[model samples]
Target: MNSTRFTPADAAELYGIHNWSSGYFRVSDKGEVEVTPGPGLNAVLPDIVDEIVARGESLPVILRFPQVLAGRVRQLNEAFRTAMREYDYQGRYQGVFPIKVNQRRMVVETIASAGYEYAHGLEAGSKAELALCLAQNLHPDALLCCNGFKDDGFIKLALWGRSLGKNVVITLEKFSELERVLKVARQLGIRPAIGVRFKLNARGSGQWEESGGDQAKFGLNAGELLQVVERLRQEDMLDALVMLHTHIGSQITDIRRIKVAVREATQVYSDLVDEGAQVKYLNVGGGLGVDYDGSKTTFYASANYTLAEYAADVVYTVQEVCKSNEVRQPTIVSESGRALTAHHAVLVVPVIDVTGPTRGLQSIPEAAEDQHQIVKDLEEILANINTRNYREMYNDAVGDKETLHNLFNLGYLTLRDRARGEALFNAILQKLAKLVAGLAYVPDELEDLPKVLADKYICNFSLFQSLPDNWAIQALFPVTPLDRLDERPTRQGTLVDITCDSDGKIEKFIDLRDVKATLPLHDPGTRPYYLGIFLMGAYQDVLGSAHNLFGKVNEAHVTARPGGKHLVELFVRGQKARRLIESMGYEEDMLRGSIRAQVDRARAAGRLDDTQTVELEEDYGEELLGYTYLEYEE
Candidate 1:
């Protein structure tokens, strides 16, 4: 019989960071989580947390590794290149980072700078994004694809991109958009390149599967696509139809679904080419899924294939379809935004407090003979717990606890008796939990005893503000301690945020089989305990809402040099109290003046002394500039 105690290394295997981190994160010798930009370099996350605290900054900081972003761009492009070479494919892979995934300036500029050599492009889905694309230093030969519903201004800006000597393609989602494209091109007197998003009957699979297929909100029907070609031909603008676009959905886990979509889109492209429409680019829009849970299954959060396998499937499918259609191999472009940026940043928040009996086995007070029968029964259950009778004892304890609650409500039991009953019941649960862990096979009745004994750790960040997907769609992101990987974690806890709402907590955590009810964590006795939420660089920042007025956390851009030296290139402060109030339409000056007036009125009425009045005014100013989060004192 072996009785090996579980350690922090066990936590790593449980969370699957080694499988999903893509060689960028590892456990250090000191048990701290180390973030790597490349070979021969790493950043200690706990040290960064220390530096942040030393600088008087708050918790819940988001650290962006631009090096990681660059590496991902290289990884994606290289995967395609390798696949193309292996298959001896005729067409080149031209990938574009969709701005909608992460529109932050540092993220977009890092992609532009790192992907210039591979001729990677940018995809904008709206006018604002088009303006952003226009300003970026993209490769002269790289593409600038304009998608989504377009107005005249949006169309004009895309045509202006062409005038500025960029390969800009305005993809038409509806038949009416064609007229807008033509009208804007005529007004600007610039030849506009166009693409058509054909609605694919093959639907995707996942949370966003509904965003694709025949009845999707975007994309043109078969009839509409034909009308676009025919109308362009009538106007002698057939040469302007340079690309065909279709997206099954975002975060597509099944590679089979991807191949089906590619084949369908390729057939549509070949049909248009056979009709004499000059389509030179087959834009297979993004569905490259990230393996969030490291399961590598078709589970909505996991991808069934690797980057190389995905590229091979895409390239081979397109090549085979075009070969059978007897059409020339068009260039393949993918807008893989999620897979590109999801690993580049991490959200680090501190566990400020705990709210359960994590200390275990507290001294239970004896119930008096005059107390209710339920309290006496709970005391009896606690006194008689043993291996053979633990199951029956636990059940009896549960029953007695319920009866004690009812007795308290019915005025039959005193508050002291109820309290003692709770403590005894909890203590019994802890003892049973320890015994259950040592058992090779626990009975099915008490299988969940250990989990039921887990604690609730209150972290210093808002779940809605930092991880909206977890709240909105139950998207799982990997979370673990940045330090203490060497020590055994005795506590299993679910994270509760500092928000007032009951829903602002994360109970489900990533697991190999399914989501676990709690996360394994160590006790944060007196030191600051930091938890890093990984793979949140994609849609989280842009989609995060200011729920409960908990604004964005401070952001830091960390750049790693070749010599392993790190630099915090930029630090954007989070929204302060005044800014948040102003964002909701209250004038800052007016609010300040009103506060000053109230203070003066109180002072004149002798409600405040001279020292108190000065302190009050100074405190008001300080509160305005204070971080919206709870500031911890050492």
Candidate 2:
């Protein structure tokens, strides 16, 4: 046992739970992770998971908190309102949720309903999203922001939405899109609400910075924007332009960049209003960042500013710019999708097994006189391992391990002998790691001793299907145990998901100060271990691929109940094996016939009897009907 007993606080510190969780989660006294989606609402995550598992649900399930989603919508709206009040701004603030962020029906409906009081609308970046937006029961006054490239059909659909009494603002992505929008509106015999996406000189600071600025694929340059204004004026539709839109980026890490973008957009908006266009809204598209790592610094995974700071800067900067330009302040519009949705979903998986250098090593006996020379050398190294000679022993172990592999390759050592040598080497490395930990100044070669001996936890989830951001963009969502947090974690580990791809592993983890290669974890000897990956409700949900045909994981819609309780109002099972194969161009009936034909051929060749053929056919049918993920006995 460790000299110091672990408490929930220690576990919290170890996992940096507070740093990245954003107060939605906390370590309880019972060592369980508790989620508080709203005030006076609390639910232990493990308890909820247990109840779910009892109902015969599998691991790698998504837990969606509608309260968190609603709370985020309300929080952002209130923040902007408070900032506008404090700054004495003239215009109101209205936000729109971008359906491209999550795009699920439930997520879209939740945000729309939650922000109804604020008249929050939806933004669509594609034709498919535009069609979905047209069907929604959005507030009559809410603005349905039509962004992205548009064709004739896309424009007609958006314009038709206007005929239905929708506040549809079709923001032109490029200068050419305006003609098509106007043409469609003329065909419908209704003047369309128009907006222009302005390409700004100021670029945001983050991975998505290139997606904005003058060189961006979307939006119109200043020169092109001027052309659009002159064209709209000639068409006698200058007053139809109701909004000026600019995108800095998504997940912007610095506050200064946001203020700069706001200044540039406000200047453009004021100029547009002066140019005889009735621009009443300034759209700062989707760049309010979420702090994935809790340091609150300017790191890429975090934001240096708070929600209050973001709101204050945006409202005040626009106010200052508009006042200087001698124009009335426009209604501030923001499409903050990441921060609104990132903390509402979590992926819960189980640690099915653990693999390490010293996991199953048995006690080594004295080296026999007739043992291989490499075996004797390993035994000698382990016997004399001490604080003073630990560094030298580590070096010797590394060299010996190489020689051991060579000897086994040359067929000089048996499997048992190789196992013994490997076990002895791991044991020496463990002792050296302990010695190196206590050293004030360690040699450079020995610094990696701890990491080299770290365990690999085989978690039961597909990284491609469940948590793709970790694999795609090096996204760092918080990973921690669901229970046993009161006890100290003795193992340092990295997670390996159950994907056939060699890249299906999460080695980089978020740290307050730096990126970590391993996470502190408790050992799961004979018990089932569970882990929760937090802050994955944003891009991770819809951006995942069906790589390896793993399909989507199960989903549980966790809604807050009366008296501080929570319940899973909806449960969605994962994809079955049959469906996955069918998607790969294999029909079920055809597959069944083909498989039966193979069985008949085998039996005709005398390879199987009738009884054996029946058993094999039944087994093959069962596999096609089962889940793609591995199953275990309850």
Q: Report the lDDT tens digits of candidate 1 across residue range 305-377.
A: 9988999999999999999999988899999999999998999998888878655545566666687777777
Model 1 residue runs over 4 Å out of place are 1-11, 363-370, 438-445, 561-565
> Which digits, one per residue and each the tens of the lDDT, describe model 2 over residues 494-566?
8998888889998888899998888888899887789999999998778888788888788899986655478
Query: Which whole-number lDDT from 0 to 100 does residue 241 have in model 1?
Result: 95
Backbone clash tally for model 1? 0
Candidate with maximal TM-score: 1
Model 1 gets an lDDT of 0.87
Q: Give the number of colliding residue pairs in candidate 2.
A: 1
TM-score of each: 0.96, 0.96
For model 2, the run of ten residues with the poorest summed lDDT: 360-369
Pairing residues by index, what is the TM-score of model 2?
Answer: 0.96
In terms of lDDT, the poorest run of 10 residues in model 1 is 1-10
